[model samples]
Target: MTPTITDAPDRAEAAALLHAVADPARLAVIRRLADSPACVCDLQEQVPIALSLLSYHLKVLRAADLVTSRRRGRWLDYSLTPDALERLHAALPAPPPRHPGPTAGAGEAATPQPYTAACPPQCADQIQ
Candidate 1:
């Protein structure tokens, strides 16, 4: 279904969230956090990006409310927000039904449906 006027804000928010994780480095950080909360140093080791670049990615995730950080002495630990999965799911448009409707007569070909955009395969599995 096409989005209505009221969906504009939702669509914008979803775009922001998706854009935040569009980067490979940010995705790596999210994947690592999904396993367990980790310090910035740990994320650096896992992602192999420069500390400044890592910080930039983390800042984007934090801005989108997908990630949270807690200070432990001089280091900071990052983790996914409690509602991260739910928020991601809500942001995505619901997929169209897999099968054609009963309107198709026996032995008749079903009408072709329009293509619908969805999360990329790499991101889809992680979110679900």
Candidate 2:
């Protein structure tokens, strides 16, 4: 297949997404929102951080489009975006082979490998 062309701006956007979820606090919030939409009160209880901090985390998530905020009466409800995980998944490079697949021999046992991808700073450089 022809190589996929990834421009600098696209890499930067992906890198920003990587940076947004890099924090444990932010990651926790994402997991919570993935299940259902919730207000600050709901998120604050799920995470140990203070309400103010929770708001900050939500801001970061919102910026990355990982979550959406909607005004509901007196509360602000947040929900995970439909394609958030997909976008993040697409940003990383495909995982490398764990152990070389079945050798030249026929009917050789092929080891099973779980999918694993990494998105370090150099990951952008690898973008085709």
Candidate 3:
């Protein structure tokens, strides 16, 4: 089901979440975590960013509640929140439903030739 704005977080929270994932580095982290939980060391290897920068991105994800971390001995393993995907999906508007267009009958041109005159000057090359 398509999620309405009401189904997602408040405007500010939703914007924060969207902004958090908008970064390429953060997106890489999310994609890696989608496969399985991994330590910061592992993420560093995959994302290839400085540890401090990676941590900063992770912190942003945590603040958005899209990722969670668990401490194991001296290492912290990170994973996506259970509702992370749903929450992200809900933050955006759904595309309008598609409607069938009129079809041409046998031997009929799909586009009427007269309509070509309506094409803008920039589209002249494409009209024919």
Candidate 4:
């Protein structure tokens, strides 16, 4: 969906947000977090990366505001931000709105002209 003007982030922040999920590991982390909150240990079980590496990915997710964390005793549990979907909605690089093609069978206007760039018939035979 095209975001409303108020829903869009400024350019630089948007770039950073897009970059956050650009990594495979981090994307996996976010995908899991989307379902529910998870601690680093919980994430490590699912992510193939080492603990240190997973932590690094989590840091990137946090920076993008794609995820949030809470400290419970020794564990840091990560969850998708309350507005994560909204930010995603805002961050989507909207496809340029398509112009309507001529309605199906609307008229001759819907037909494409034949290719005129082909070599002239005489030239075609010369190469043959």
Candidate 5:
């Protein structure tokens, strides 16, 4: 989806989200959630990080809305928020288009003769 400037979380909020995922360990946690939701114990198995560290990372993620947790018996299950992820992607500048220049060439037999069309009114080089 196109990302309007207002489409993202506020700058401060966005910064918070970026900071939450800044840690390498926490980033891995997000990646894991990308595949499937997991409880603390299940994440521990996948992350191989210390319990305290994992908890801290999860706290960061929760605060940023990147993840949501629910009580499941004694465990808290966490899942990714796809909208948050999309907002993150939208906030970042898009990569430039793959092909940027004129495609036609002199040696290309299928190339049409150069012809100028009426430029949009706002175009600086618009024909009179």
Candidate 6:
């Protein structure tokens, strides 16, 4: 079922999601899944964790909706849900706005200006 977030309580749901992905192991699992769908065994190999431990982490990720799993024969293949990444991306803080600094010829204390050459221009008469 699609989760609609038209109400304020839904923000808790978003926070739960962020909490789930905050784990380093879970983050690694998401990165691995981003490349290709993998079974638990594949996840174990990629992450170097015990099978039981990996299973627990996968459960957490699944509960947070960051990943989905489907049984293929005897193996459960795992993949990242695009929506989860989108939600996390939306929660990120925006970059700060840039302020314009002083420019040349503005007369500000910090303004940059080029120094003129000390040599004077020579006319033919002056040269003679």
TM-score of each: 0.71, 0.70, 0.73, 0.67, 0.70, 0.66
lDDT of 1 by residue, 1-128 (tens): 34322377888988888788889999888889989999999999999988999999999999999999999999999999987766776777777655645798766657775443586777766664
lDDT of every predicted structure (CA atoms) = 0.84, 0.80, 0.86, 0.77, 0.77, 0.76
Deviating ranges (above 4 Å) for candidate 4: 1-9, 96-128
Between prediction 2 and prediction 5, the one with superior TM-score is 2
lDDT of 2 by residue, 1-128 (tens): 32222888878888998899999999888888878888888888889898888788889999899999999999998999988877777667766545546562465545664333565666645652
Ranking by TM-score: 3, 1, 2, 5, 4, 6
lDDT of 5 by residue, 1-128 (tens): 56644544466565676787889888889989999999999999989989998998898888888899999998899999878677677555677544323774555444343334655646634533
Cα RMSD for candidates in order: 10.5, 8.9, 5.9, 7.5, 8.9, 15.4
lDDT of 2 at 59: 91
Best by TM-score: 3
lDDT of 3 by residue, 1-128 (tens): 64557533466667888999999999999999999999999999999989999999999999989999999999999999998988888787776554443686665545534345778877877765
lDDT of 5 at 73: 92
Better-scoring candidate (TM-score), 3 or 5: 3
Candidate number achieving the greatest lDDT relative to the actual structure: 3
TM for candidate 2 is 0.70
Root-mean-square deviation of candidate 6: 15.4
Model 5 collision count: 0
Quote the lDDT for 93 in model 3: 72
* Alpha-carbon lDDT of model 5: 0.77
**Per-residue lDDT of 14-109 in model 4, one digit per residue for the tens?**
667778888989888888888889988889988989898898888888877788899999999899988777776676666554343567453333
